[model samples]
Target: MNTSAFFEKRVGWTKYTMLLVLLVISFILDLIISIPTLTTTPKLGGIRGTSSVQVPSSDRIGMERVEIGIGIGASEGCMWYGKDDRQCRYTLSFQPSSEFLHLPPKQNVTKHFPDGQIMATCHINTALQAMVTTSFIFGPFFAGLLPFTMILLPITVFMSIFSAISLLIASGQVAYHLKYSIPSFELQWGINSILPFVVVFLQLVLSIYIGTLRCMMRKKNPPPPDMTDEVRLEERPRDNTLG
Candidate 1:
């Protein structure tokens, strides 16, 4: 099926899939490209973490949480690093230590200094930086762009569709639409129930990463948004048929 018509005809089915593929492709492209900001390490310094924790290898893609520790310095902020070649707000871990530090002690809260969550964030963020930066650099060269729109167009279109589908599936599994249990992941709940929420947030970030690559690839000029919808009837044409 032709591309534009395929979109028009199966728009509903394609909606989520479209988003997914875009994200995957962006992640891939981000991995490929080293344009400018690939060299810097996302400044995740002095992020108080458990001094030592077991980092087990699992089928699960991102870094896994191991232990809990304390919170210290610069309570809340954002940073970007490595080469995810992805976009915006840098890394994606929730600041549990930040919150725990800020919060006053309630009855049963077990607030540990440099806890597992902190350790987990550190590992996940650093690893992700590497993955994303690598992907960004790879994307552009993988589908090299010359003046010839014919080859580029098919590559862009096909990659968009394929990557989007893959992304959707990957993200759906992350999003909890399709349930597959990871035993270790299950154990993380003892530390914090909201850990999965962090996963969803990171997945969304990955989705956005793929989208960035697609935007870089395509060419279009979208019209400005129409802004005259809220005018009152009395504001104009007060007289009947005032031609």
Candidate 2:
């Protein structure tokens, strides 16, 4: 007896799943990092304390106080001397990490501190905005449709490249803003900044690989031609048996 077999053709599913997961990770990280109140640690305070030789209690009065130029913003106050009683005061301020990227640069913030002191500066640049938009919109959209079709593979590759470039530029902008705008506090880059680069690289490499595989698969096993049900039935071989 002889048997007929049909072998179904398919692409690499492991790599495809990896690419989807990578894009999803990028989307999540981007969304989390964009939050306005998100802040990272290792922030250096502006104040520096000095040690003095042991002295009388009376002489130690006001010795611990160090003069630092503190910026004050609107809707906040300094509680230096006392809540009610007041003395010469300065405002200590620190803003969240995301505010450095989202807010407009030209906004007046005044408090009970010296005037003209620069607080946190927030300016969203094109690269940063692009990266954010890609992560929130493009990343998820591409990831969602990737498993179903190969048409978006090439576009995903390009989007990954664009996202990587935008992320690099955004990192530079954030670093610059942190270094110059608010030098008082030293903010360190956490996982939020680092993981996106890795995700982007994986996405780029996986998409390119998958796209190449797709091309190869197409060349190896061309898609079957479209046909009507009647034609398909007519093409089917009829079995004949003799008893």
Location of the lowest summed lDDT over 10 successive residues in candidate 2? 1-10
User: After superposition, which runs of candidate 1 have C-alpha atoms over 4 Å from their true positions?
Assistant: 1-116, 144-213, 219-243
C-alpha local distance difference test of each model: 0.31, 0.35
Give lDDT: candidate 2, residue 184: 31
Candidate 1 lowest-lDDT run of ten? 182-191
Give the CA lDDT, 0 to 100, for residue 210 in model 1: 48
Report model 1's TM-score to 2 decimal places: 0.20
For each predicted model, how many residue pairs clash, with residues at least 3 apart or on different chains? 38, 2
Q: Write the per-residue lDDT of candidate 2 for residues 1-243, one digit (tens) a residue.
A: 000000123443455456556655655544443332221211121211111122224466653322222211211222121122222232213333222222224422211113211221111222333343344333222433323334554454455455445544544443444344422323344343454456556556655665575455445432233534555688889888755
